[model samples]
Target: MNLNPEQITDYANTFIKVLIDYSPKLISAFIILFAGLYIIRLINRFIRRIMVKRNLDPTLTRFLADILLWVLRIILFVSFISKLGIETSSFVAILGAMGLAVGLSLQGSLSNFAGGMLIILFKPFRVSDTIEAQGVVGTVSEIQIFVTKLVTANNQTIFIPNGSLSNGNIINYSLEKIRRADLTIAISYDTNIKEAKDIITAVLKNNPKILETPAAEVSVKNLTDSAIQIAVRPWANNEDFWGVYADTLQNCKQAFDDAGIIIQPFFKESSKKNNPTEQLE
Candidate 1:
């Protein structure tokens, strides 16, 4: 079908009319989009400065700023679409439903991320700090977004989910400058308790790693069927804890041997002797 002059003119007129009608909204949307992007940048920079001033962790700062930037941009995008006379309620609802689905599917990951954020913010433990948490005792090597890496004394690397780590009991041994080392020394019932205590006390005092300000003490902790338990309390710097502990045990054992005091390993053997069922196992 051939278009007449009137038909061509009418089509042109209709196109011009539509453009004229939507020109302001289109222009406004473009202006708002650019302006909103600039504003978001400024806001992100301002937030980063504030976080830095507050001494927040660098990782958390970047993560939070990125999240905020995206959230703000999403809102701005919705507003821009609304400015173009498009219905946004359905769009927002769809977005919300999609967000819910994603959140549900990544629930554990989100929880771990939140846990990591909390841990970084609160600093319950720091890198290189010896901490006991979730039944694992190790030095924290890295604190990631979803997990914390720990290096055990045996040089084993353990990855603990931040969710459980943040929620569980954390014993930070390196948080304090000083720590007390508790050792239970079991001696034969026939040995002299006072002499054993004196010898242990001397050993603790002689060790340079042990702190003298608290005055190390040795006392009777318990008495078993065949042995007397002595509790040796020694104070040392956090870094010297393991060293002092090992030295104390070695020195005490040597001292006991020299003093003719018997260190008994009778608890398990005595139990086995008393329980005939143990041998069967």
Candidate 2:
């Protein structure tokens, strides 16, 4: 079909008129889009600086800043769409539906996120703190949004979910400035308890790592058929706890040997008795 020139001109004029009518709104939308993006960036930077000044956890600071920027950008985008003669209610409804779907599918992740927020806000433990949770003990290497990383004493890395960590029992060994080293050693019942205690006490006193304020003590804790259990309690700085523990045991053993104190081998004797022929031999 062939159209008349007049009809073609009329259609062109009508299109031009519509464009003219919407020009201002279109221009305003573009301007707002650019300006809103710039403002969002500025706000994000300001928030980052504030978090840094407050010495907040690096992971939490970055996560919060990114979330704030995205939320503001979403609002700005909705405003821009509204300016271009689009109803924002439908857009918001769509977003809500999508969010619900995502939340349902990632329920565990959302729980971990909430747990991480709690950990960051309350600070139950911090990076570099040695903590025991969920039957695992390690130094906290990093605290993340979903998981916490730990490095064990044997140099094994463990990733624990933040959800369980937050709800479960956590023993923070590094929280205290000082820790007590509790060790038990067995000596033959024939050994002189007073002399053994004196030797152990001297060893504790000679160690510089052990804290003098608490004053280490050695006492007979229990008596069994084979030997007497001696409890050695010493206090030391948290950083020096393992050192003091190892050194104390070594020093005490040497002291006992030098003092001629006998350490009974009860388990060995019991095993020998279990084998009548070996015991007889």
Candidate 3:
């Protein structure tokens, strides 16, 4: 099967001619590939700048930019392959099938991703907001594609899947600039309701954190066998809610003690009646 030198030269010439014919297409494809990558970077940077200017969420911004870049790169790759005389329709079909398989396999993750998108768009809560959701109460530390991170008051971290988070009941304590502190205090039945109310009202007024506009309320809420339950509600700035709440309780107790308003301990009468020896004393 050995060819003569003249035949070998002809074969070499044919190969060289084929290379010459395809040289421009190959060079153009390479140029397009590089140029497309550079353009993609530029587009990504431009999008990021716009997102920053618009004050979009950082997590969503980065995720969207990455998706856009990858999609663009995939299109560029398919185009490059097509330039080499490959059938891109079959390539696209293969990609579609692979995407469908991956989508089916990652259903939960995709749902979480969609949930994250909804959260980002609607903004039920934001980073640093104190929220109670899915039986976890904490400050939102991070909102990610699959989960939301929360830091509890005790400094414990919790990761909640976004899918359930989006669907669950969320109490965003930080949404309101002001919050009401509801405290219930019990006093002996013999204690004068008006006097006790006055003492508790004074406690609320003395606290600087409590708001003055709405006016604090202290009223008899209910009566049990041993004591009268008084409801004390005071408004305070959200940031000062806990401080106001703790301070009001302490101050009210002290004021009541000083004013001779007797606070009824639970089961005090029951214990006294149950113990006949103590009753004799």
Candidate 4:
């Protein structure tokens, strides 16, 4: 309380000297940080525009953009923290310790994510394609990063994980312009093979939608206990599959009936009303 003037002057001078000493480092760090951050933001935006211009997959573009921004943020954050007198070694160590745990917990999900990326890149199938995968057959409606959705021929919706789709076999029937229709018809053993083949061939030949290139094949496929099975295959456009299928079937039946061919229903014999005891006796 007694030496007030000198003490006050000394304290003020000392404070000013300390600030001047560290001001250079502080200012340098601030300038470097601001410039680096601004450049990072600019680079991220530029990268996004380039990706879009290249017509890259929207999901992939977004993912890459996020990664770019995160990397820049990490660099800036470490530098800023160091300026504030905090060590980055301990921070990086903590991150390394936790990263493994997080990755393990999300292993399955991450695998599916990778699978999704491959699907988008390779494009084995797309929306509206009829595909058979994971033992389910349906028309694809949406293919997302995590899952793929399908609508069945009966109008049922099915969702499959991207991992399963990529890991398993997939059959894309809609990719082809023409699909071969396989039909099996059975007739009584007494029926003439020549007449039946001719009649079936004529039925398919009458339809213009059926392709003549493959040449509809009609051959006796099997000789069962009481009937002869005929194998018929015809090629037609994908859009006309169902229509051609029904028409070809109806025509074959009509042709067989006109030629006096009797189609023996397989199960009628075992369930025949005739008494077995009487026949045996």
True-structure RMSD for candidate 4: 9.0
Tens-digit per-residue lDDT, 107-190, candidate 4: 888788888889878889877888889878888888777788988767888889998889999998888989987767788878
The residue-by-residue lDDT of candidate 2 on 169-197, one tens digit each, is: 99998999999877777889788888888
Compared with the true structure, model 4 gives a TM-score of 0.72
Model 4 misplaced regions, further than 4 Å: 1-86, 266-281
Please list the residue runs of candidate 1 whose C-alpha ends up more than 4 Å from where it truly belongs after superposition.
1-24, 120-122, 266-281
lDDT of all the models against the reference? Answer: 0.87, 0.87, 0.87, 0.82
- Candidate 3's TM-score reads 0.87
TM-scores of the candidates in the order shown: 0.79, 0.87, 0.87, 0.72
| lDDT for model 2 | 0.87
Q: Which pairs of residues collide in model 3?
A: none
TM-score of 2: 0.87
